[model samples]
Target: MKNNFYDQNIHYQFPETFWWGSAASGPQTEGAALIDGRKQSIWDYWYSVEPERFHNRVGPEHTSDFYHRFKEDIKLMKETGHNSFRTSIQWSRLIPDGFGEVNEKAVAFYNSVIDEMLANDIEPFVNLYHFDMPMCMQEKGGWESREVVDGFVNYAETCFRLFGGRVKYWFTFNEPIVPVEAGYLYNLHYPNVTDFKRAATVTHHTIVAHARAVEAFKKLNLAGKIGIILNLTPSYPRSQESGDVAAAHISNLFFNRSFLDPVTKGEYPSDLVELLKERNLLPAVEAGDMEVIRNNPVDLLGVNYYQPRRVKARKEPEPENAPFMPEHLFDPYIMPGRKINPHRGWEICEEVIYDIMVDLRDHYGNIPFFISENGMGVEGEEKFRNEEVVIEDDYRIEFVKEHLKWVHKGIQEGANCLGYHIWTFMDNWSWTNSYKNRYGLVEVDLKNGLKRTIKKSGRWYKQLAVNNGF
Candidate 1:
């Protein structure tokens, strides 16, 4: 939270081979949601049924229209000094039926997008899923059903065979735990189930799907590295007391290590497993699921750090008839004087990124990783527009600079960190919240036909990319 985290006098040059770019997803950016053989995803279905849940009643059907304007967008990416970019392939678009023939038009569109990026000298980092499940698959018990897992594996294999030759950085899932938490636990996403047991199954099956996809990617002998993107929020105890520390430990087990350990270390944290077993909330794992997860570990990792989680020992007893939840083990501890993002209501603890890097270096073999998604999403950013019609978003530039300083320090300390990609390249649609908070280097004016204008941060980012530092 200190303003002195970034010393302007220091020339923090990154490696020459560092990737410089940002990330966006198909579901959030690509419009033409139901066109050219595209089918409905969970977002589409949820919007149709409960449009009121979305901000201003806006749905996913008409996003930033990336489908039609990708060529223009790639040009903007180049203008902003993007050498590498990450985005997801919509499963519903690629395989509309979820278990049937591929959609050739969708194939043509994605191929064009990838080819366009290649032509623009931009490397494409394609993710397989981004919380966008096909409605048909969701109808078939979603992630709870093993059949859906097999279908997802098939879909991933199809993508590998189709686009693996050009795209060298592939991600199996973007924040796989988000769906498990949002849809199953928090009721923030579609199917709005609040059952912890069901949530456990969903989480397990998602890991199974990821491992199977990694297995498939390796089997294909593709010229690409496959991994998963995880949003890791490091948990901090309110105090160093034994009870509070134990609470933080359990919090880490549920939120961070549950996925991190299995994908990287090839198994779940033993204590996490024991905890779940003791609660009778363990997911149904098949005989060879563990082997699949163990044998096929990710070749790379994409970390998205936004904030740290503060926790303390639970002070309240759970009612006997209450549904079980992770919150039962700990209570959220709001640290006094902690910096907060008023727009998003998230704490701003920039040092957590360095802590994450050091932890990975010490405990997780220092696996090759990158800052996959980091940015500040501000509401009513138009208020910051200058006379030049550019958003003078100095705050975003400071946010990136501060985080990158910690990233540079981590690299200096021998963390195998590779690159940093902001949360998005352009302002695009977000889930439920829609475009309520703008987080982009380039501004997309939805009121003006999604007009694309480079923000001041975009200019700064270009210089940062060119200089390999700020």
Candidate 2:
């Protein structure tokens, strides 16, 4: 009976209230890294010290210039048929000291951006954190310190009191697990230190901080829904063997459930706790931390899906003296003949989106969620730009259409997914990638006074939003 809602019609339409737009962050899009009382974030500090780490040596200061041209960009958002959009308020920009008075210019900038978006009838979904930790906070031990957690709660409560009236959707963090893995476990991001204990501590404290923020939001009686954005990479096993299946489950526990469970279920999975305890790697926690997590569950969820993870049982034992890590429990498995996005070197597995929604329905009580970020990243997109000042991104069109079909299927089957937003609104600096891969429906031409032209995919997305589906 639930599936009957999806008839045999060739054209699939969505509910009239569905959200349509894209997602981006302030540091990645706004270029005023120094102006308007904006101090240094970890990205700014890292780039200044080691410029070579960034792609083409392009730093965060050279973003799409959205800081000054936000009015024009907001117009572009409306032209592209966006009913809702997601962006972050930079912590470094909002409070230069990370615990000081709010900057008036920063306040004015955010107020104008939110007001402009509202004037254009585009709902502004404001996120509090997006990997842009203030340099001052990092100086005092970043997420590893309980003091930093308290500072974060204060920041969140201030934002709620300041802007909760206008913004209906607020997320505590975007892809919260990435910092744990990238900054602590791997050397991919800033403060590149590979320590299992530190990684575990950071991961634990971050989730606890999110729960605390939710607690504060509810306590303040903020007139909005609050949640955290998590990047869910559906883990697949190499085969049906118990060892392989167990490896996949472990991988999911670390990458997906590390944040998902605490925010939604209020406690860490016992199996994960047992594994960490066996290795003496359990993070430091206080007496009432569990209660804080237990009492406050998110009202909504923001899911960022890009690629599925394929893992298998480890083949070799770890060196006796090697640093302990998650890979000790599982290894990567690259399947043969898997569909690939050659442009980005990531697998193109659209069905995983449907599988994720099904898991949420059957296992997680079907909590309300949305695809906050999903889009193809293609390098050398300029090669596709044609004579009419349009970037013909047909591959991106195919990518989005294929994913939406699975989303439609999940919604028809009664999954509580509310809407879909792409990975980005326009091409912006992507961390170390630094605009190497373009994932925008509208192209930002830096060579032409930072000119923005709607790509072919942007026009088609407008049509799909107008039709409610394709």
Q: TM-scores, in order shown?
A: 0.97, 0.97
* Model 2 lDDT tens row, 1-470: 43322334448789889999999999999998988799999999999999999999999996998999999999999888799999999888888898969888888899999999999999999999999999899999999989899989988888888888899999999998899889999999988989999999999899888999999999887678999899999899999999999999999988888788889999898888998998899998898899999998999999999999999999997556788988888999999999998878999999999999999998899999999999999998999878887899999999999999999999999999999999889999999999899999889987898899999999888877877788
Model 2: residues >4 Å from true position, as ranges? 1-10
- Model 1 steric clash pairs: none
Q: Which run of 10 residues does model 1 get worst, by summed lDDT?
A: 1-10
- For residues 234-322, write the lDDT of model 1, one tens digit per residue: 99999999989999999999999999999998899999899889889999999999999999999999999999999999998755678
Query: Root-mean-square deviation of each candidate, in angstroms?
Result: 3.6, 3.5
User: Candidate 2: deviation at residue 61, Å?
Assistant: 0.9
Clashing pairs in 2: none
